[model samples]
Target chain A: MIWNEEYETMPRADLRALQLERLQETVERVYARVPYYRQKMEEAGVTPADIKGLDDLRRLPFTTKEDLRQNYPFGLFTVPLDRVVRVHASSGTTGKPTVVGYTKRDIRTWAELMSRTLAAAGVRRGDVVQNAYGYGLFTGGLGAHYGAENLGATVVPISGGQTKRQIQIMRDFGSTVLLSTPSYALNIADVMADLGVDPQKDLKLRVGVFGAEPWSENMREEIERRLGIKAIDIYGLSEVIGPGVAAECLEAQNGLHIFEDHFIPEIVDPTTLEPVADGEAGELVFTTITKEAFPVIRYRTKDICRLITEPCVCGRSFVRMPKITGRTDDMLIIRGVNVFPSQVEHVLMGIKGVEPHYQIVVDRQGTMDTMEVQVEVSEAVFSDEIKHLERLAQQIQRDIKDLLGVSCTVRLVEPKSIQRSEGKAKRVIDKRQL
Target chain B: MQLEQIAIFLENKAGRLAEITQILAEHGINIRAMSLADTADFGILRLIVNDTDRACQVLRDAGFTVGRTEVVVVAVPDRPGGLASVLNTLTEAELNVEYMYAFSQKSGDTGLLIFRIEDLDRARSVLQAAGHRLLSGEEVSAL
Candidate 1:
């Protein structure tokens, strides 16, 4: 399908009109059933009559993850559990798992969204889509699973974490599309080479949609080069109904088209939780309309990104958001100063002779919080002795402190000493127990 | 001769030892002997407390991992070479002492040596037959 015919390429007027209709109905349904939403709307001084269209969404109160947890399992459901056919839950680090329910219609809507996301990434009919996302609880697997099936492709529901098996399926299945996190994809490439198979030549993969983790663009290019596939970033949350919420089209440009028909998007201040104007960086908020089991209104996503008002080179006419830079919760606060590991990664990428494997250690020494980072030395920059290695560490420390405005001690470790993750790498080790 | 030890697993951090001790102290648990084994990310702290079961329960309820094991506690003369005598006996027994700690009675009558041994029952019987006094749990705690 061409760009114009895709749902992402809908005209601006039609997109807005479609969003308003969905928003009006979603608001009316929530106000009638969900008690927590009714309380929030009453506190925000909004009623079903107030939200006539998308423009009036601002008057309605925004729902939050805490609301879902407080109403854990099925409190937020507009329809009973009998009507709901499926359930998805968060990792529940904050508290009880924030569960989301979906009706058969809701599942269809989700499948259709994933199909749109895949088509945007150029996964056409007759292609083999290898989905390596984790199957249960996480939306990455099943979301891609349905989308590939709808695209008329042979589906490989290869759930994540078996290094050897992943490579085996990619080669044996003749898979044309590989779906996994960027790190796992790179690890798979490394394993393929170790297994004496050429990643660029042996595998038939032409496209990749990687998500469920944060990675830099440098990492993306690295994966693309090793695998020789156009790796596109897929964005989604279980609250908004999984992957295919938004995707990067063929333009390979600065944004992803937000599927605005079933769900409305808003950019808001990370701290105050208020809306910001277009072309500004802020936390993403989503309001799920046309949902039957669990419809959330204005749930804050906590991701830091910017949405572009201009159309893409592919002419999708949809507002494409920039790749997420970082999460507010992941930022480290040391001795009354704020810092992010990604900021350190940005500086390290700019400098030569430094690798990606690093760990932050925070400890209390003599009435002060001392911060230290252990950076792993790759084959490219291996050095001998504490004297020479300490000098290299000092240079890294100076550069990171200059960029991040926080002083830290840097120690160099031998290659592969720092732990690597199959999914999300553990980045921080806080020795100071709070 | 037997030494009572309490082992508690703690996630590596600054105030963990303090937290474990404070929890014991709150419940009137006194530490008779203690040692620590550490790794990069975590540490196992061992203690011989007045009441082993109660102390472990208190720490467990407080979210600290506590465990129990038998340690060799032997009595030697309070004079010089008191520890040396026990060492020579263990050497003859072919027991390689991994780690150890020392404490004394309140009257300064005898010296108590705690040894981590590979064979607890055999070492205890050998030391006892050699006429060494094995202090009971109460004797260690009361001292």
Candidate 2:
């Protein structure tokens, strides 16, 4: 099931040599074509000639989201506007969207990578793919659409929303593969239950390629159990050629294999901006070597994860990265203690009767920080006697403290009280002024 | 005999109780006896209704968390110490009543008490042995 076995199963030594050559060409091309990159390279006292091999990637200046925003639309493109065939942007809530452009060849590369991603997740030619990612501006929708088509699979361009219709289409169309955010996949499963449609018996969804947001393993179990599909994690960003950067192969669910032949990934200590040893958790950085229209030299993804060069059982020689545990931006400093919303989610998922719907509210109380986790309980647990309910709340508090090492108040709300999201579930609400 | 009581979970907010009762009224289901236990955040509305299955269905369809529990309904005299006498007998039999509520017939000199005990069958036999009359679902609905 290794898609494009020529590249996916390339020997490690050969892949490294290919990565080095691409990295050198990308650094030289960006330095010569884009003044912004030239300025950054000069400021770092590093020239294109300095990038001799793949290990020299650390010598290149890191490009961040802020850098992309500063450049805005088309400023970072190596090719002219006429050559850029497609434009997609990430929705930034407060400012202009992080824009990305793809040349005709770049688009083809993206489609090929997505095809590889889908095949890795067990998607085959002629299988029906129901793409539920949001289209327009966001890369997830169209990115997955073209990839499904490129993979020779039937594409149902059913973008996100219309939850009821989404379910109906899945049944009537006999979709075997689903493409969407992990949270939305769970939402679809919930809607299926509401419609009395048995996912296992009534639907044809055998595998799901879910990404665009960080999710825990517990969520994977929940989605798989509810939707009766094998949930596979696919990782990418609009900044780095959209949803086909890396994907978890069906044979080894341990980590996602980065498509190393196209995008070279590195782990770095966020604070020091230095590369971390392989297998150590750190911030993830991607260098799009083959991108032409908009080539990022060394883009800081801000996602925290570890890179695993360990050979996968799936026969693909590509390096694998574990699921993102958290983002540097999502880290909260409460009373000098660092906490991530994913940590709290991990704790809540272990406790019974507590639905995955939860919100972490952090506020300041006279120089001291207070954290409160508001979670929803199932109907059966919510209807229990008062003392039992109180005990459940206390147990959650104890578990969070024991697991996360942070003391937080636990509030058990009634079912459906918490607002559910169609995309990324908002898990944190920090009211601290700082 | 065992009687079925419907329990609905209601958030402790204004008009919640009215909402449930309105749904029941629209369904033509009459509430025979009821008791509400509440905390600061929520409440459980337990009721002895004329139609258990229909009431539960309508309320659940309206998005309410509703469940049913079995209880023993006894006919106690309206005179003083009547409920106390029944409680004393149950105490002698070591049967614990989890919860209880009462209602009276307009013309009768007797009050009906709905008792949710640990064991419905054991409570019925113990109460009947002490000359207490237990009301069945049919008898309670007719009243």
lDDT of 1 by residue, A1-434 (tens): 43237456678898888888888888888888888888889998889888776778877776776677778778999998799888877544332456888899988888888887888888888999988887876677887888778778889898877889888888888989988877678777778778998867788989888876555688788788888888888788788887777888865635778887777889888888768877788998888877788888988877889888876787677787888876666655454234566666766666576778788887756324578887765534432122344566678888877766568887655345568889978888777532
Q: Can you give the lDDT of residue A419 in candidate 1?
A: 82
- Interface RMSDs of all predictions? 14.1, 2.4
TM-score of chain A of each: 0.76, 0.78
lDDT of 2 by residue, A1-434 (tens): 77698999999999999999998888889999999999999999999889887888888889987789788878999999999899998643223567999999998999999999999889999799999988887788999998889989999999987989999999999999999887678778877888999998999889999987666788799889999989999988889999999999998788999999999998999999888876899999999989999989789888899988879899999889998876777666454334667778777778775667789998866434689998776666664255666788789899877765558988766567677889888778878543
What residue pairs clash in candidate 2, if any at all? none
List runs of model 1 lying over 4 Å from the truth: A1-6, A330-434, B1-113, B116-129, B133-143
Give the Cα lDDT of each candidate: 0.75, 0.84
Which candidate gets the maximum TM-score versus the true structure?
1
Question: Candidates' TM-scores?
Answer: 0.66, 0.60
Clashing pairs in 1: none
